[model samples]
Target: RSPSYLAAQGCWPGRRLQGSPALSPFLSKCGTFPPESCFFSLICSLGSFMVMLVGLLRYAHVIECCGPSLLNTLGLAAGWICAAGLTMVGNFQVDYAKVLHYIGAGVAFPTSMLFVFLQSVLTYRMAKTRGHYWTGHLRSILSALAFITLVFSGVFFVQESFVLQHVAALCEWIFIINVLVFYGTFTFEFGAISTDTFLVLLKASQAPKSYKSDSSTASTPHGHSHSEGLAMV
Candidate 1:
């Protein structure tokens, strides 16, 4: 399943329902809803961390393929921060530690956005260098959309009106969707990596010399060859 699907699973039927308040219903209160919201929180943490880790691992290929660049490094750093932030968010429940929750969220959200932007830039650069369209142009379009939605989300969040706040919430979800879709663009690259890795592992596991012959003769305590039949005489 897509990482986004995994993430949505963490929060579905719990909060942020259709035609609801601007803020996540859980965020509106001190504790989680249905008293089991922490479970979802944990899910979010795990899913988010997994997604970010995959993205980070993808960076090794990026670095190898694209060579070292400041943008790539920045994107990797941002991804690490995003993953750590997600872990923190999961570990610290909002109701239990509001300060810590906000801190974690603060780290996660902006860095997540930053990761998106840096990755988009890097992808665009790589596409241009390789003369590829999908990674460069298509990904650029998705990144642009994500950036726009994120801007709307941030803008609406600062507004005083409930309707605007709700709109902001909706935009936030849209931004997330864009980010998820953007990540999906890497499917081809990931598949290629998996295939190559599998082939390399298969080759490494197969031994050319299946069997070996003893190069030296074995001798018995009587100074006779063990492999030779003993003389009847």
Candidate 2:
């Protein structure tokens, strides 16, 4: 509807209709108008917040289960950066803020690809159960598809042909969908998370160094016994 509304006002490229062959509209372009732009901005902002929260939870989850690793840290950074880019994309309309919008797009797309790839690698590394293995395999496929689509979208976007541009737009949509689905996959692991997981992290962070060392010395034998019981469970 926004596309058609833009078309009616000659806001679209070549003043073409929504499905016309002249120029396939970018998602940003569809939200360039008044009412739709407001909704677009709101949705993007909310999405960015959700992405950031999810990234933090994932980082904390990894720290809790597998201990800290460089890959997990890097993935969190990439996810947060991508979220920042999304905020910029939503607030800056391409028509009015072309440079800022493109900059945001530039930041968002590559970082999102990196984030998914890193998470996929981490998933494989952390795989213990059959379900974890299957999750890794699914993430790997989605990461590959996302990277391919992102590359094609970028390459075709600069082409002179409208048909190519339409293809590029299609690829862009696919890339976004793939990324969203990748985020959705986190539910598999998140399901097993409990409040104790975060509480342990908080306590570990707040505990004094002297107390930690003393506790480690005192509990070494008991810790081993507890770990074995946990593993068996």
Candidate 3:
């Protein structure tokens, strides 16, 4: 994601600017996805890098840091797909027509996410159940977005081919928003796991109020077992 690249694209002032996006220069926004998707790649890479760093500092942190894996993975993969599609389109280099590029952008981002979400819902279900249901719900929300964009794409495909050129811009804005939302969840989960670990350590490092506070002092075998189970859980 380079500013220079963006500057190059922006300087072009897409055909959509010529008339309404619906009746622009090119009909198919088909293009090769880039090596790097715009700023979105940088953000995704940075976020993943940070999570890896945190995992190194704490064990099991990666577990918390890694699932909803599908969405995160798809977000990253879609960036590449966009880059490829863009390349195939040439960003209007030979011909200043970008409807194909927009079409690709519109369909690729969310479609990839949908596949990713399906993977998450199916793959990460066990001890993760109560923990990650919301992840599935989020997937559903995005699935709805994908459906709408897909329908719009279909309309453009069949009726208004020119609109396909603009679909990428309008639809991809949602991709940006989706990235933000996913990051927010990632931050929350990281914080949750981190705080949970910190609290457990705080309790462990603190001296027991008195010798009787030790687990061995529990009145009955059942009491000691219950306390142990709580600690393990």
Candidate 4:
């Protein structure tokens, strides 16, 4: 399996997200074979919310380091809004809070699509500036796949046929899967930096160790620390 596939080890599949009667009136949320599958809605929603949080945190770190301008700031804000919207959707199920559920979906889906595009641009810029060719190419490809799938998802949203609904459901899943894949690619970016070591250092002083480490260890601007040995695997 691909690394991205492995990263989404426990996420719910595409079919789980297509249960609501409002979206697919013909299909039953509860399947006869398994019996009462409607609860998959909760699974899909919560899983998506968690995945979105990963995107928010990783991209925010990248922006903070590489994106210092007004545009990057706005992009980060949009990313946060997108994450919030996903959380809202998870909390407000369609059966309980129809208005709130749709509202959350409205905010989450579009913002997610927008965030991918913005991240793509950011990646392209970083590739040129920092000479990260493979990362940029991979992100660009994932962004394009996400946009295409999301577009199909939107186009099939208003269709009445079950066939169209099935296609739309698949498209939505592909879109989300691509988003998760893009987030997984951040491992490459993360590998380039010592953020993990710094994070350990930030808390290292609180730990039992009080002494500064030797020169062989990782070196900070101020000095060297034992945490430097903890490389960004």
Candidate 5:
């Protein structure tokens, strides 16, 4: 819908100025207008929320399977930050909030790449079966493709030529689609999750602060008990 609006206004792939510089038809550009901007904001906000939820679930799943670790913690942070960037990108139109929009783009792109890479590493580290190994291989390929496309998109976007700008936009679309596909891959692991997984996460989160000293004293045994109860999916 936003694309159609942009196309109607000759802003889908904007034209070059006769004597001035031209701007590429970025997805953000689609939200520069009135009605389309409304829809853009709505969609972006929803997507951002969904991304945050997915990140949380993934973090919880990892904790349930392998217990919490720095890598998983970093992955969770990266995912949430990426979601925040997406929220900024969607709510602030590039034409109106240029600085903030670019900032959002900067945060969203790199953090998303980081998220995928960390997830790929986690997949390999956690793999115990033939299927798990194949999943890791698939994730590695997606991560590599994401990195390449992201690099190309950034490189091409800064060029002075209109053709290069278009190429940048194409690369940007590919990068986004690739990331979405990577997220979809989580369905395989998610399918294995059980009620106990959620129960463990709930108990961990709800545990009283008064038990901190006791928990610390018995951390090793408690951790092993948790690991035994929360079987890997």
Candidate 6:
């Protein structure tokens, strides 16, 4: 039970639909709503964390490469960890959750994703003849500020109802839309990385090995060239 739930006294009996003309009409039995709401919070935390783990694992192929993918994975992994940490705070305390959330969702995740993009572009540019695009700082403070404003503003709406609720709902939707856009863009870039890496590894694994012979003839440089020519024939 989070601090807020504990603080709220686990659903005040008379307070079910209090102050709000909207939810009061549908009483919907008894104390089930509060428990259900708690369960939903748990699910959100678990789901977000699991999804973040999957994203990081996908980029784990570069463990030894010391390449752009390593940076891409690390930045994203940090973001997801921050997100998970915030969600955990939400499970235990509302204020703590909000504070952590503002940092994670608003500051960490988006900025981390921005780094992922920069690393990807840098690595990609390196592989390509035109390698100039890899030069900029992809994590922009302006973007982070916007996300922080949007995130905290939506979080501020959780307890709202009548008028305040509506405004909060609008902010919530705006935040969600922003996240969805980030999701789509990241998905595309991740796909490209996966496909490109797979193709490269596949080519390497399937390529013919250099010709070698067991006899002394194969040990000599001229013999190696002859073996190569013979293999081609």
Best-to-worst lDDT order: 2, 5, 1, 4, 6, 3
Winner on TM-score (3 vs 6): 6
**In candidate 4, what are the lDDT values of residues 1-233, reduced to their tens digit?**
23356336532333222332322321222221222333544555665666556554555555546644455555666767776777666566566676886787788888877776777777766665555776788788988888898889779978976678778778877887888787787776666555654454345334444344543244564343335545533
Alpha-carbon deviation at 38 in model 3, angstroms: 10
Candidate 2: regions farther than 4 A off: 2-23, 203-233
Model 2 lDDT tens row, 165-214: 87888899999999999999999988878997788667656767768788
> Which candidate model has the greater TM-score, 2 or 5?
5
lDDT score of residue 54 within candidate 1? 66
Q: Which is better, 1 or 5, measured by lDDT? A: 5
- How many clashes (backbone atoms < 3 Å, residues ≥3 apart in a chain or on different chains) does model 4 have? 0
What's the lDDT for candidate 3? Answer: 0.46
Q: Which TM-score value belongs to model 2? A: 0.80
Q: What is the lDDT of candidate 5?
A: 0.86
What is the lDDT for 32 in model 2?
82
Give lDDT for model 6: 0.46
Off by over 4 Å in 6: 1-35, 57-66, 69-74, 93-169, 192-233
Error of 2 at 175 (Å): 0.4
Model 1 / residue 11 / CA error / Å? 20
On lDDT, the leading prediction is 2
Give candidates' CA RMSD values in order.
Answer: 12.5, 9.9, 14.2, 14.3, 9.7, 12.1
Give the TM-scores of the predictions, in the order they appear: 0.64, 0.80, 0.37, 0.60, 0.81, 0.41
Question: In what order do the candidates fall by TM-score, top score first?
Answer: 5, 2, 1, 4, 6, 3
CA lDDT of each prediction against the hidden true structure: 0.66, 0.88, 0.46, 0.62, 0.86, 0.46
